[model samples]
Target: MAKIKYSPEEKKTLKSMFWNSGLVFAGFNMVKMEGNAFALTMSPALEELYPDVEERKKALVRHNGFFNTHAVMFSLIAGITYALEKEKQTKGSVDDDTIENIKAALMGPTAGIGDAFFFNCLRIIAAGVGIGLCSTGNVLGVLLFILLYGMTQIAARWYLLRMGYSFGTSFIDTVFESGLMAALTKSAAIVGLTMVGAMVAGMVNVNLAWTIKVGKTSVVVLDVINSIMPGILSIALVFGLVALIKKGVKPVKLVFGILFITIVLAFFGIF
Candidate 1:
């Protein structure tokens, strides 16, 4: 198979495409979240690929359909799609349906993996690190989180885009066959869980103010609980919120509910 090479200008345009992926949700809608933006990102390449005005219009319209995935992982799809389009323009063997089918197949798996690794794992760990520092009154914590997370995201996008272009559709098989994806995800999950535990202990605070009265002697309930197990209240509170979330409670409602409860408890001097 012949390799498809990109010029320096095209490479620069691809980098712009990677950065612009974040804007995918800007034109989000019930029908086509990120679809329009995807086409917009591909506009430069499509223009270069199809010099015929009618063909360019057709290519744009073809891409303007329902397409949604994790923003970072979308770079891989973008690269692959660009390669396929290039192949179509040059070889005229690959059809539009084949391109669309490949997209449909890849998007779901990429979203699943990307969400688990980037959203659930990396994001939580970054937040944990930032919040840990913030709790200690370090204002740079927020900046640190943004810089670390943002840089990693940009790097992933750049690498994956190039990988997709270089390997084309075969890259997908190579990824799974190598087992790196699974190992990477598992390692991220372990780190994520560790950060979550640390966050619960360091960030969440809950104390019981009620006192037990016996023969005119008062015992602090919080002190007694702490003597048995430190941060028990915090852990319990975290679990309770997680249970509620699992039970389909809306996050906004849960936040308001917690606020109301905290206020009432504070008023009663029992929290």
Candidate 2:
């Protein structure tokens, strides 16, 4: 990574990207959450890639799709996308689907790592120390939280963003040079799907309280299900929603369906 050198123009573009990426929460929406910030962060690179007016607009629209991830991972993926877009313009090895698929694949795993480290570990430690200080009437508590948690995340985002660009470019170039582009794409999709399944198992919960009366005993349905295979129901629910979404179902309807089903299940003493 240290061997990678950037021209002055490249340095300026990356500097602008690092600053723009800090506005990760800007123009957030259900359809394209974080996309506006992603486009903003990628703008400097995109401008350098696509000099023509119409082509630039098309490239911007292509990137402004639904993208969601932890803010730290968001910068990383943005950096990778910049590299992919550059590849698309220069070598013509990476196409639209390849870029989009790679983005989708990287987001989940990177997000899980980022959240576990930053949100779960760092945030708790920072808050605990900050709370301890504030309780002792030290104004430094609030500032400490900002310094430990906030500033740390900002710095991490910047580092990961640059690393993503440098590493992604080198990695993509290697794959192309070795004629393993398709293999790598397939591998990435496999890993992405595996991560999604793992997330569903860890995060999704089906709180089953139903019991069946056997001849002389009561057997808990959830326990029986778990015995057969743990979290199968959660996996099913997640994949089912994914299938529906692929079939063009809107997210709002799915949310309402989940709410309705949960309410009905709760009323019947199952959730």
Candidate 3:
């Protein structure tokens, strides 16, 4: 919404990227979750910015590195990257590392915002209305959900994508002028970690069912544990799994190990 105008070629490239951003999940993998989709989305921009075939190929390879975020942020990052790429090609200011670092810094915070807003709030509202309609035998509920949640996502993605492109240059310049790149990165990282901690606190639960009897009294072991430190078990369990993961433990093995441990604990009345 700036007092700005795009050239015909810029419009064409952005249009291409807007459509390509929707395929963010295509060919997703653990090693590079959305890297393929990201590369595809940046194709048009890279093609335009780097006319040389070899440079464009290198740009593609560079963009295809371990990108993952919510769909909305995916488009936003692609737009921002497009801006960064243009700067790199034109001003010789932003380098490949700067582009990558900016993407990395934005990914976490954008993911937390996107997921919470879309998945938790908008999706739930849509589902609530949709379910009510469906229960009444009206098919409009399902259609409404799609129209409400899906179309909103599309519109928002387009808007934010353009916003990123329009404002990214100024934002980057401000960061450079203020020498706030490191501070910005660290702050974004803190927000990202806070979001992760909130998720862990909400989702991970250690429901202890252990009990013991002494004389005529029965005591709940979980209560005693909680008295010592509330949610300590759950925190420990989550961190323990995370540690195992960092140690290169395979996910399948981790799942099976958890199951086996659960079964043993249940048998011992310590579930």
Scored by TM-score, the top model is 2
Q: What tens digits encode model 1's per-residue C-alpha lDDT throughout 1-271? A: 2355778976876877776765777888644667988898788778878999999999998998768788888888888888778777876655686677677666667888999999899989999999999999999889989977877988998888877777773543454568664553355455545655764686688867888899889999999999999989899988998899789886568778888998899898887
- lDDT value for model 1: 0.78
lDDT of 3 by residue, 1-271 (tens): 3445889998999999999988888778755689899999999999899989999999998888667789887888888889999988988877787677678777777899999999999999999999999999999999999999999999998988888898886786787789987776566566656655665687678898988999999999899999999889888987897799789887568778888999999999899
For model 3 the TM-score comes to 0.68
lDDT of each: 0.78, 0.85, 0.85
Better of 2 and 3 by TM-score: 2
Instruction: List clashing residue pairs in candidate 1.
Output: none
lDDT of 2 by residue, 3-89 (tens): 478888878888899999888897787556787888888899989999998999988877877677899888888888888998999
Candidate 2 ranges with C-alpha deviation above 4 Å: 191-271
What local lDDT does model 3 show for residue 30? 55
**lDDT for position 61 in model 2:** 78
The predicted structure with the larger TM-score, 1 or 3, is 3
Model 2 scores a C-alpha lDDT of: 0.85
**Model 1 bad stretches (over 4 Å):** 1-5, 169-271
Question: Over 4 Å off in model 3, which ranges?
Answer: 175-271
